[model samples]
Target: MSTFGTLFRVTTYGESHCKSVGCIVDGVPPGMELTEADIQPQMTRRRPGQSALSTPRDEKDLVQIQSGTEYGVTLGTPIGMLVRNEDQRPKDYSEMDIYPRPSHADWTYLQKYGVKARSGGGRSSARETIGRVAAGAIAEKYLRLSHNIEIVAFVSSVGPIHLFDPEATPSSDPAFQSLLSTITREKVDSFLPVRCPDTVASGKMADLIAEYRDKKDSIGGTVTCVIRNVPAGLGEPCFDKIEAKLAHAMLSIPATKGFEVGSGFKGTEIPGSKHNDMFVPHPTKPLSLATATNYSGGIQGGITNGENIYFKVAFKSPATISIAQQTASYTGEPGTLEAKGRHDPSVVPRAIPIVEAMAALVVMDMVLQQQSREATREMLGRAARLVPELSRQEEKAAVEGVEKVLEAVEKA
Candidate 1:
């Protein structure tokens, strides 16, 4: 269950307060240039103690490539990586042995496994995401070099404050669409503490997080992610829609409460006529089509349509606050618990990279799966000829024919 993906599989190990936390990334394409340098940047971004907004755990998060590479090139074998735990303090979590912190994984993990880790939240800790970010870096490298795909995530909201007005429809707004197409990680990181791109909103969000931190509490927020240049037809239909896999990957992250793509729930308020994405000819590609609207989030009929894919992930406030709370123990005995640990008052800032990583994982896996399918289809040839393939000229003629018919109807 710890492993994810079908082709580009990743299995992560270790836990908070353990020796180290890392992951084994399998199915990297052979002979591509790879090293710790490519992976370390994201690890650094995801690491704790980066600024006053996050936990002061003081982890360098320096990743080391243990195997599956030679002379800085991946060897088509499982890539092993590790990051040592340097600043662990198991004694800080000694009180958690009896009372499971409210809304934390302690109680449920105990009920499921019968025995839980004596310190920290075990696998539920944000430290476990280091492996995901590392593995994602590798997948991202492959995608970037091969397809020029760009993935970026930024904090879009903190508590009730939003980067855009709550009533504004993001999918229909030209500014939001332009932001999705142009916003980069550099632009995102420049506004630290809160990664919102809007200068004014970022300031407000940071102050809100600081207010909660000073009160020894936590606040929740949302991160909006966009992926550009994803090739068309990269998802399975029925059970494994691209959006479904994306939702699954995102919700797996700790503290993530909800997931939505494109217009998301807002689409439900409009009728089908307004919500539908009308097809238009791609500006640069002769035979390809583009969407006039992206209410479907660049995916239609469960597959990507070569448009920018965007989504929002909602993260709950960190449950392990330093403030004292009245709660019950494993034995159901009432008591006061003052949780001790270094945790972010707001997680969306650091969660940006994690969101990007998970999105990379989902897209990479889907890409590989689609590639395999295409390769097999090519090798087998069209022996059955169930559906005849259309030539480029024929496709163009068909589009012109449709256009002429529509024009005649308009004239009538």
Candidate 2:
């Protein structure tokens, strides 16, 4: 289950306290220009020690491209990458041996595997997302170069403060639509620490995180991601819908509590007439259709509609706080557990790149599957055309069927 995607496969390895953490990415198109530098920016953005709002775990998260490329071009092979774990403190987690931290994976991991990492949460740690971010960077580069796709995610809410209230202002509101259409990473990062984009909201969110950090507590928040210029007809139907795949990928991240697409839960409050997205002629693309409204969130019937795909992911507060809590040990014994670790007071600020990365992986895998189907269909169409006798016979049958239908209607 560590491996993700059917066509564009990514398998990640290594735990939190392991020497290194990385991933092997398969199915990258050949001859594409790629390098470690292209993948490092997002990795650095996801790394810790960025600010006081995040964990002070000093990791450069410097990525090294180990294999599957030469001379800056991808070789259409599995790309191997690694980021060394330079700042691990095993002694900090000695107490984890006795008492499981509340709302953490320590006890469940032990129950599932009959063993757990002595130092940290192991695969359950947020450090596991490093591999995901690295693989996503590669996928994102391919998506950008091939399709001009742009993926941007920012902290939309921290605690009770939101960039805008979804209940009061639906996603169909002009202001929210404008933000989704025009918000860029540069504009998002310009408002640092919280990355909420709105000056007033980001300021308030930062102060709220500071309050939690001071109190030795933690808080949860939401990150909204927008993907643009996605080609239509990318997602699969039934079980593997794009939104379902997106939810799968997103919830796989370390603290994600919920996932919602388009207007999400708020749309439930509106009548169908208002929630519905009406089809209209595309503004720019001739002979194509676009939705007058976007309650569908750029997707209809489990397939993309060549519009912006936006969704929000909610992450729960980090469980490993410095505060003391009443909890139980591995045995049936009551105890007071005071967890120790350099954990983020709030994960939303640093979760921006992680959300964007997961989104890229989902879209990239779906695109590859779609391209393969298209290529196969094109080949079959060519074969069908080469058989002139079969083609003529089929055309005559179609004409006869239409004539019969017309005659039946006239008789009626």
Candidate 3:
């Protein structure tokens, strides 16, 4: 289905070469504040051609809110957002439309849909993610109000280069906030040919990307995302498990080659004795149960455990790099092709915000699910502080009622 989540439904539409692309967010609560400005920064981060490391295609990526609100605040209706495609260069892709780029969805889309758009890979392009990022930003705002959740993603790896310690912890940990403060689109672009985050590794990867660029080729990298302050009990169990939902949301992004949560693949190597998170109850904070180690990555039993939840998604480098390779035309004739288009040598940096956006979408969906259970005592337990003066009034009323019953028994 094009839409995601049962309550916080988001449906994205349009083609890469289409005049416009956008998303419709249904089920947004009324009175929440929203506007184009709230969603624009995310679009800017995901927009291509922002730096040398990203594709050279330039688009203003302006967002316009058409419906779902008046005067900035949500009207409790479906929220609709639009971003016009301004910097499309269809001519550069005219030839590949017939041949289909290797490792791309051109062939698969044709087989499934029977027809395909001849420009910019149409819906398959990363351009489609614009709607997702926009809609996700709204979800983020909703989450910040509902649960105080914050999501961030950064360049964790590029090619063989990674953010590693000179000893064991690395020079600086790749925390989302810390990494974002240091890197910008310009900084990333200046070193875009190689998507490395570490200066030492970036320098080496840069040389490698330039060398490959000279030879007309590309590479791949991985992005790591962290979800912080996600309230416990945000996930549903089993099939709609939080991790399952997160993977589903993330895998939909173009060129996303892999996904893993927490220790992920590494968990396989450790013995059960070493891998399990042992719960330790806090004294003063009786409500808190925490593990000294966070190998579970803040999730247990498919629900958030109020710990930092982190994951890594690997993206194959831009396939449209100017590489002369042997392939066949749509007619099955042998041919030599050199892809010509404005493209990133690597896309891991530009994809940072997209990763954060998807995580926000998932967490927000869970928060809404929790909100729907507000009446349950178990749910109420989580928000005891919200009752304010009503809690004291209830207690006083109970005491008075008890005394009246005792007086009636004595009179009898």
lDDT (Cα atoms) of all candidates against the true structure: 0.93, 0.93, 0.78
TM-score of model 2 vs. true structure: 0.94
Whose lDDT is greatest here? Answer: 1
TM-score of 3: 0.84
Q: Rank the candidates by lDDT, best first.
A: 1, 2, 3
Off by over 4 Å in 2: 389-412
Q: What are the per-residue Cα lDDT tens digits for candidate 1 across 14-122?
A: 8898999999999999999999999999999999998888899989999999999999999999999999999999999988887999999999998899988888889
- My TM-score estimates for the predictions, one after another, are 0.92, 0.94, 0.84
Poorest lDDT segment (10 consecutive residues) of candidate 1: 383-392
Q: Which ranking of candidates, highest TM-score first?
A: 2, 1, 3
Question: Per-residue lDDT of 1-412 in model 3, one digit per residue for the tens?
Answer: 5788788889999888789999998988899888888889888878887755457788889999989999889998998899998887788887776588888778888999999888877888888888889989998888878777777666767677666532333211345335533454355545554444567777776665555556667777788777776777878988888998999988988889899887777677777797787888844467798776667777889988877787889998778767778899999998887887777677777787788788888887788888788658666686776687788999999999999999999999
How badly does each model clash, as a count of residue pairs? 0, 0, 2
Give lDDT tens digits, candidate 2, residues 353-387: 99999999999999999999999999999998889
For candidate 3, the clash count comes to 2
Q: What is residue 126's positional error in candidate 2, in angstroms?
A: 0.5
